[model samples]
Target: MSQHIQRSIDSPLRTGLNREQLWEDHDKGLIKCWEVGRQRAARFPELANQCLAGELPVLGWKGGVSRSLKKLEKFGSLKYLAQWQGLRGEDLNIDLSEERELTCSRTAMVVTFTPDRSKYFNQVAEA
Candidate 1:
C-alpha cells in the first residue's frame, strides 16, 4: 500500500486536462477513454495504483472503458487486468479469481450503480 501510494506521488499524471473540459469532451465522444483514464490516474494516482495492483478490486462501468483499463493494467496482475476491454456478460470480463467479489472501494471513478440496477456492480460496492 505504501509503494502504491508512492507511485502516484512519484509519477504524477502529466496531462494538462481540466476536469470540466474532460467531461465536455467525454460527453461529446471526442476524447478517447484511455486519455481520460490517464487523467484519472494522474489526479488520483494512489487509488488508481491500488486498483491496478489488485490490493483491491476496482469496479468500473462505462468508465471502465478500454483506455482506463489499459492504463491501469500496467501496475501488476495482468491475469485479472487483461479482461478490462471485453464486453459485459462475457467470460473474459474482469475476473477477481476464487469467486471473490470484485469490489472497488478506491476508484478513479465509474464505480457507479445500485444493486437494483446491476447486481454485478453491487458486489463491487454499495455506493
Candidate 2:
C-alpha cells in the first residue's frame, strides 16, 4: 500500500479501519474494486449503462486535467496517452495488455465527470 493511503487509513479522523483490517478484508476478497460515475448513473442511466457494458470507454486522467495537459506538453502526446492509460489501469486493476491502435490527436481534452456536477477539463493540445 502507498504511504499516503496508509496514512489516511491510520488517521482516526480519516477512517476508523486500520491498515491491517483493510488488508485482511482485501485478502479475504471481501472488498471489490472502486466504482466510478455514480452521480452520472443516477442522472443519465442510459449513458452509464453503456459505459458499463463496454460500449464506451470511461475516460479519466492521472490528476487534474490542467496538470495532465501540462504533462502532455512535457512528454508529448503518445507517451502522455500511454502514461494515462497505464496509471488508470493500475488504479482500476484493469488489464490493458490486449493491443489496440491508440491515437492522440492534435486537439485532445480529458473530459471528466464528478466535479460539482460540472465537467472538469483541459485542452490537451493547442490548436
Candidate 3:
C-alpha cells in the first residue's frame, strides 16, 4: 500500500482531508496564530530570541505566509542584511540597490538574488 494509505489506516481517529488539520488544531494552542508580529519574528530565530526576551519595537508580517525582509526593516531587524553579505563575490559587488553599500566579513555565497527585470520596476513603483 502507499505510505499515505498506511498512515490513514494506522490512525483512524484523524478526522480531516489529511493530517494537516489535526496538526494545525494541536499547534493553534501553542502559538498565537492571530499575532502576526510574533510569527514574523519566529521566522528569524535571532529576532525571535529577542522577542521572547522582551525587546523593544517588533517585526510585522503580511502579504503572504512568509515574512518579507524589506518590510521587517521598519522594525530595525537586520537578518536580511547579513544574508546579503553572504552573496557577495571576492570583488564585493553586494549592492542590492544602486544607492546601497553592503559589506560582510564572511565568505561569499554561490547563490545570488537577481531581479525579475520584467517586473522589478513595476513592483518597485507599487512599493
Candidate 4:
C-alpha cells in the first residue's frame, strides 16, 4: 500500500546545492534549445512549414525548396519575378538582414519556383 518516494526539492539544499542556480541553468539550456530551433527553421522555412503542416518530415535538404533569398535576387521581373511575388504574397525585401519575415518569404519563393521556373533556371544557370 506504499507508493514510490521522491526526493523533495529541499533535499538538494540539504546537500548544499542552490535550487535557484539549478533553475537558472535549466532556463539557459531551454533558451539555447529554442534559439537553435529558430535558426533551423530560418534556414529551411518551407521544410519547417511542411513538417508543421504534416506534409513532410524535417528533412533539412527538402527538394525543390529552401533556396537562399540572396541567390533569388538574380532573377528579374522578366524572369518570373511576378510569379514569385504572387505565390509568396510578398515582395523580396533586399535590405533585410536577420528578420524572420524575409526568411519566410524567401522560402515561399523557392517553394513556388521549382514547378514552373525551368526557363528562368536555365537562363540563370547558363550565365
Which predicted model would earn the best TM-score? 1
Worst window of 10 by summed lDDT in candidate 2: 2-11
lDDT of 2 by residue, 10-111 (tens): 122224666666435532211211222333345666644544333323334322233234433222222222223232322222222221232233223333
Over 1-127, each residue of candidate 4 has an lDDT whose tens digit, in order, gives 2222122211211234455643355232222222233445557667456544423121221223334445543222111221222123232222111111212233543332122234335443311
Model 3 error, position 35 (Å): 4.0
| Candidate number that wins on lDDT, 1 or 4 | 1
Q: What is the lDDT of residue 111 in candidate 2?
A: 35
Off by over 4 Å in 1: 1-31, 55-125
Q: Which candidate is the best by lDDT?
A: 1
A best-first ranking of the candidates according to their TM-score comes to 1, 4, 2, 3
Name the better of 1 and 2 by TM-score.
1
For every model shown, what is its TM-score relative to the native structure?
A: 0.26, 0.23, 0.19, 0.23
lDDT computed for candidate 4: 0.30
With a 3 Å backbone cut-off (N, CA, C), the pairs that clash in candidate 1 are 34-67
lDDT of 3 by residue, 1-127 (tens): 1111011112222223344553244332111222223334446666445333323222221111122334232211122222222111111122223222221112111112222233222332212
Model 1 earns a TM-score of: 0.26
What residue runs in model 3 are displaced by over 4 Å at the alpha carbon?
1-33, 61-127
Kindly report which residue pairs in candidate 4 clash with one another.
Answer: none
